[model samples]
Target: MQQTTVAKTVTYTGIGLHSGKSVTITLHPAPINSGIIFARTDLPGIPQVAAVAGNVTNAMRATTLESGVAKVFTVEHLLAAFYAMGIDNCLIEINSVEPPVADGSSLPFVRLLEEAGSVEQEALRNIIDVKEAQTIRVNDSFITIVPYDGFRITFTSINPHPMLGVQFGDYEINTETFVKEIASARTIGFMHEVKLLQDQGLALGGSLENVVVYDDETVLTPLRFSDELVRHKILDVVGDLALVGRIKGHVIAVKSSHAINTALAKKIIESCSK
Candidate 1:
């Protein structure tokens, strides 16, 4: 299959989840084979950074890519939107270190990309298909990629909170489901964790508007889906795998986080290359 990118630039502005500062990001048409690269516009000379598992040096609360003195944080949702939409190459230029946490969902980015108009390229795309059950375990959490004919993801969580109990979402990646099911699922957080995250200088851009904040028993807004939390988890997984370069095979994750996801991605790429 051929690669794709939008014809024109799309712009968006929102607050950074960590920096607590407003940020403006623009998606520009990149030459074929460029892949998804991030450019730090605020720095002198505007250095560029590649979006890949090898570039992901930090996977704390969110996935972070760093090279030399430059870094970008919280890239999963944006990456997932592009991956599920089948965008193969593009330039993500940002005025800040992180993209805007727009409504804490990929919906805004999805809309922006559609408005910009996507175009097919001449080069054939590359996908890393699983030849066997490739698995990686970290402590009690584990992620595995198994052989499948097309792209699919299944995610399960063990959060005890009422808003986040055991839940699951399964889908064969396609344009219709990507926009309706995955893109609208908002990233969620706990009300209590907010104070600690703030103390650590994280989630500074988080608010009830962007993310679904919950107390012990109450969700901040109406639930988008009964299993919205799980759906969002799948959303995150899709985004993280986008760093793998192109759409691949089935990925199954159980009780996994950003750290474990990136770790599994590294292992998969390494194992497949050999």
Candidate 2:
């Protein structure tokens, strides 16, 4: 398959998940082989940051990428949307350090991409076709990928909360399946963590509207799917995997988190390069 970029420009504005500051981002078409790059529009002279695994500095609750003095936070959802839409090259201009946390899922970003449109490029895609298995783990959580003809993912989340429990989802990822099945799964959190996060100066934009919170007693919002927690794990894996640009393999993850996800991404990049 050939590479692709946007057919037209699109803009999105909303509050950041962490900074809670209003920021606007514009997606612009990039040349073939340019890859996905983030530009800080608020800073003068247009400093750019490449959205690749090597630049990832933090993945606490969300993925953050930094290069020199420029950084972009909470990028997983937006990257997942790009991966779902088959967008290979683009310049995302953000007015601040974070992308908007619209509805806490990839849906809004998917909508942003739909509004912009996509066009094929004249070059072949730069992708990794796993020839051997690669794995990484953080305590009980682990994720691995092995050789496969096409891209597929199987994810399991082992949260013990009654609302979450043990849940799993498997999908042969493609443009249609990602949007229809995984794009709308909101970010899940425990109500107990809200106060802690705020005290730590994080998740300032998170709320009942944007995040699905579960107290020990019950789930705060009606779920989009009974297995949405696992589906969102699938969403995150897709975003983390997108750091490899293109992938052709099968991945199995259990109790995945951003740190482990980004670690697996680094392994994929290292393996593919050699």
Candidate 3:
């Protein structure tokens, strides 16, 4: 397959998820093999940060990439859009540390990229083909990848809440499947944890419209899918793994978080070098 990039520039403006501040992002077409790069236009000199596992500085509540003094937060949503859309290279210019949390799902970014369109490049795609089984474990959560002809994911999310117990999803991911099955899954949070997160300066812009919030007894918002939570987990896996470029494998994840997902990404990067 050939590398691809947006055919034209597109811009979107909204409120940052963590910063709770207004920001604008402009997506520009990039040359072949340039990969996805993020530029912090608000910072001096407009420093750029590459979307790679090695540059990840934080994965607490979200993925954060850093290079030198420049940092970009909560990048997984946009990155997942690029991956599922088959976009190989892009230059993202943002005016804040975090991208807008549009409906707390990748669907908005998907539509934005669709508006920009896509054009094939002269070079071929750089695909990471998983040759052998690789697994990473963190506590009870684990992620495993095995050789496969195409990108696929089998995810299981386990929550003790009465409203959410165990959810499972299996999908062969592509543009069509992603748009239909995964892109609309919104991020989730619990009412009990809201104050704690806010005290730590997180989820400042989250709302019922942007996040699927659950209380002790029931979910505050209507679910898009019966298993929307797990579907969103799969969405996050796709986004976090985007750091390693295109992948051809079957991934199985259980209660995986950003840290665990990015650890698998780092593991993939390390194996490629050997």
Candidate 4:
């Protein structure tokens, strides 16, 4: 398959999830083999950071890419859109440390890319084909990838909340399925954890409009899917794995977080390099 890039420039403005600052990001088409590059327009010299596993310095509640003093946070949602849309190259220009948390899902980014359209380049895609199974485990949480003809993910999310006990999802990732199923699934937080998260300097911009907040008994916000939490987990997996190039494999994740997800990406990078 040939590589692809956005056909035109498109921009979006919203509030950052953690920083609580208004930011704007513009997406521009890039040449073949460029992958995804983020330019920090607010910094001197407008330093650029490549979206790669090796550049990931933090993956606490969100994925952060850093090079020197330049840093971009909460990038998983936007990257998930690009990966699912089959966009091979893009230049993201932003004026702040974090991208907007539009609806706390990939849908808004998907809409932006849809508006920009896509152009296929002459170069073939740089696909990382998983020839064998690889697994990374952190306690009870784990992510495993095995050889597959196409990109697929089967995810399981386990939560102690009564309203969100255990959810499972399996999807063959493509533009159609992604837009219909995964893109609208918003990130979630629990009512009990709100103050703690805020005290720790996280989820500062989260609201009912952007996140699905759950109380002890039920979800405070309406859900796009009955299994939205697990779907969002799959969305995050796609985004974190985007650090690697296009992948043809079956990813199986259970109770995995950004750290585990990116660890799997780094493992794949190492395996591919050998």
* Cα lDDT listed for each candidate: 0.86, 0.91, 0.95, 0.95
Sliding window of 10 residues with minimal summed lDDT for model 2: 156-165
**Clashing residue pair totals per candidate (backbone < 3 A):** 1, 0, 0, 0
The residue ranges of model 1 lying beyond 4 angstroms of the native Cα positions read none
What is the C-alpha lDDT profile of model 1 across 204-248, one tens digit per residue? 988878888789998987777887788888888888878887646
Cα displacement (angstroms), candidate 1, residue 49, comes to 0.6
Q: How well is each residue in 190-259 modelled by candidate 4, as lDDT tens digits?
A: 8898999999989999999999999989899998889999999999999999999889999999999999
Better of 2 and 4 by TM-score: 4
Listed per candidate, the RMSD to the true structure in angstroms reads: 1.1, 0.9, 0.6, 0.8
Query: TM-scores of the models, in the given order?
Result: 0.97, 0.98, 0.99, 0.98
Itemize residue pairs with steric clashes in candidate 2.
none
Query: Per-residue lDDT of 1-274 in model 2, one digit per residue for the tens?
Result: 8999999999999999888889999999999999999999898787888989999999898898999778998899999999999999999999999999999899999998999999999999977889999999888989999999999999888887867789979999998999999999989888789889989888898888888889888998889999988998899999987887789999999998888989989998898778
Per-residue C-alpha lDDT of model 3 across residues 19-40, encoded as one tens digit per residue: 7889899999999989999999
**Could you tell which candidate, 1 or 2, scores higher by lDDT?**
2
- The stretch of ten residues in a row with the least summed lDDT in candidate 3 is 14-23
The residue pairs in collision within model 1 are: 80-239
